[model samples]
Target: MNATAKQPISMNISALPGATTREMLADQPMRMTISKLNFWYGPKQTLFDVTLGFAANHITAMIGPSGCGKSTLLRTLNRMYEAVSNARLEGEIQLDGQSILTQDVTQLRRRVGMVFQRPNPFPKSIFDNVAYGPRINGHNQPLAEVVESSLRRAALWEEVKDQLHKSAYELSGGQQQRLCIARALAVEPEVLLLDEPCSALDPISTAKIEELLVQLKELCTIVTVTHNMQQAARVSDFTAFLLTGVMVEYNPTPQLFTTPSDPRTEAYITGRFG
Candidate 1:
């Protein structure tokens, strides 16, 4: 959706270590937990000692102002902060009761996929775009099966089924976003993290992604960061509100939106201020 066409993803070696190993991650259980977590970039602390739990097979949305650290916290969950040279973290983040900080980072990411704000498909053919993750992780299965199943899971198979070999650039912006989702799903991640996934799409495309998210929660835990209250209310089972790098409130989506306990949350949701 951005002006630039999708570019081939570059390998992020820094985010690869401390993750579960290839073999171990494939066998991980369903639970994912975050405990007493704190994060900082050099001297700038972003997250406080935040502790929270996400249920298996549910959708959790993180909402807050632009600089409230929602995205920072999401990146920390999957060790995306590792990519930054001066980033520092304290406390434990676990997937299935296993501390992710102690696991092989690459494996952790493979088990936990992320979709960014913009639709960023690879420059390659559509099939290759979805297949990239599995190929990089050394999946030996037949390529056709991998691509088809992944596309189906991402809810993009039918739309792109006939154009599998075409360059991802040719697809509509919405299709490219779904293709990105398919690329993440290809590896069969246990948890999917979406950061403002619908920010770049039009209203119709945004609705499609929301519908797909509901379907995705049946298979994996989903944690999304969004600035849109309507989108969070529409898709998430739970919602967490952050401000100035602190979690002000976290509750079931219905309660958070309709009867938030914190006055700040109420004001933010009521359009007083972000």
Candidate 2:
């Protein structure tokens, strides 16, 4: 999720007071760091003790074959895994510097927002869809400004500027996905997690979202899960290749694609095997 304009540095923890502790530091004024992380759905493990760090103001793409746990790892970043009936997680995900797994999940969700593969806009007007997160989070700003700002950040403002009251479903697939991004941006999360967000869109729509991702990275740390190899190369500064729920390699995008040290990463990127 992207920030509006540029938030004042004064709003930092200095104003919140006593947020100087290690727990508060984990909340991240900047980046997200995951260490020795693992996850499982019931008795079946989906993630290994993965360790990775997503730099602030950059996009890190997670790439792998289906069920390699890319999406599962994305969910764990924000504790979406906790909602499932038998899901469990081990290890820590530190945002900025704080361990989110041990913190209040409700609070964690506010700091980490996610956009899914498919556009799942609410059955509401376009304006309301963008306004939903703020409304739910008890934001009392002037509704018009918040809606406009969020939509602009999502790169959907020009298209929907005239149809704020139209039902969200009225928008095309790409527009709907952008609306979802706007909805997530409404809450001003410190980190934005996208799970194959362009998979359901057309090429044109995918291009638009990719452009939006580049812009959004300027305002928040971004972690995206994608099956598109070109996209990983095009949009990400760093890329991590996973296989069977294990991280094979992680490095700068150029290096990872052109000179991967791990044979598995090279094979996957070169269209050999996933």
Candidate 3:
């Protein structure tokens, strides 16, 4: 792809009045879909009847105020919520038109990799950290090649190439985050879910990660939960706004940021309230 060429918008899902989620995605090629998803932690419902589609090879960002269900919804995509005691979900989630709920949990995770808010690199060497997933999944690919390819994809290979055997902890915060990303990419997931992946990094690190994400979208779909609206606008092709567990608006990134259809979305983005 030409670096200067604009990416063709696959769907015209602007934030138009009365537009339904199904209508928004009707013509797009979706890598994942969520239908009437309702989730709860014990008796407190956190998500309510949310429906959305993630376009293949595109980045979709979920943005909202604190305590909104952005992270909760992201977790549902890979069944990460299963770790929370008393957590339960109702509704259907599909990847490539197949119900993900019925798939093996282990396999589902492999196909839908996740990175959390903080960079939680393993205590082992940098090389071993990126190689962990492939080893555990029994991938027979050459480990050295996979490590190099994954690091290169994450935009960290050049920085860490000579220090492959160094502990992941030795890297700066930004490098560690990119290393975590390399670990996720090693498995060759079809969808990558990130929850505030840049929250802890400095501006330069954040920019590198943002650039890496743009490049990675050519290989996989990406759904990220970010509190920073600017980051969402800079990196995502689509943006979804959630308020108090309800989907307020979802549209192409430019439209949602500039001319939001919902008053709540407008207020939040304009800094009137969160």
Listed in order, each prediction's TM-score against the native is: 0.88, 0.88, 0.92
Q: In candidate 1, which residue pairs get closer than 3 Å at backbone N, Cα or C atoms, i.e. clash?
A: 16-106, 17-105, 18-103, 18-104, 18-105, 19-103, 19-104, 19-105, 20-104, 20-108
lDDT of 3 by residue, 1-274 (tens): 2322112121224333455543554456989998888898999988877888899999999999998899999999999999998999999999999999999999999999998899999999999999999999988789999999999999999999999999999999999999999999999999999999999999999999999999999989999999999999999988999887878778878888987877778999999877
Report the lDDT of model 3 for residue 131.
Answer: 98
State the C-alpha lDDT per candidate.
Answer: 0.83, 0.84, 0.89
lDDT: worst 10-residue window of model 1 = 1-10
The candidate 2 region of ten consecutive residues with least summed lDDT is 4-13
lDDT tens digits by residue: candidate 2, 4-40: 2111111222233342232332343448877777788
Candidate number achieving the greatest lDDT relative to the actual structure? 3
Q: Which model, 1 or 2, shows the larger lDDT?
A: 2
Instruction: Give candidates' CA RMSD values in order.
Output: 10.7, 10.2, 7.6
Which should have the higher TM-score, number 1 or number 3?
A: 3
Best by TM-score: 3
lDDT tens string, model 1, 107-186?
99999999999999888999999889989998888988999998998788888899999999999888899999999998
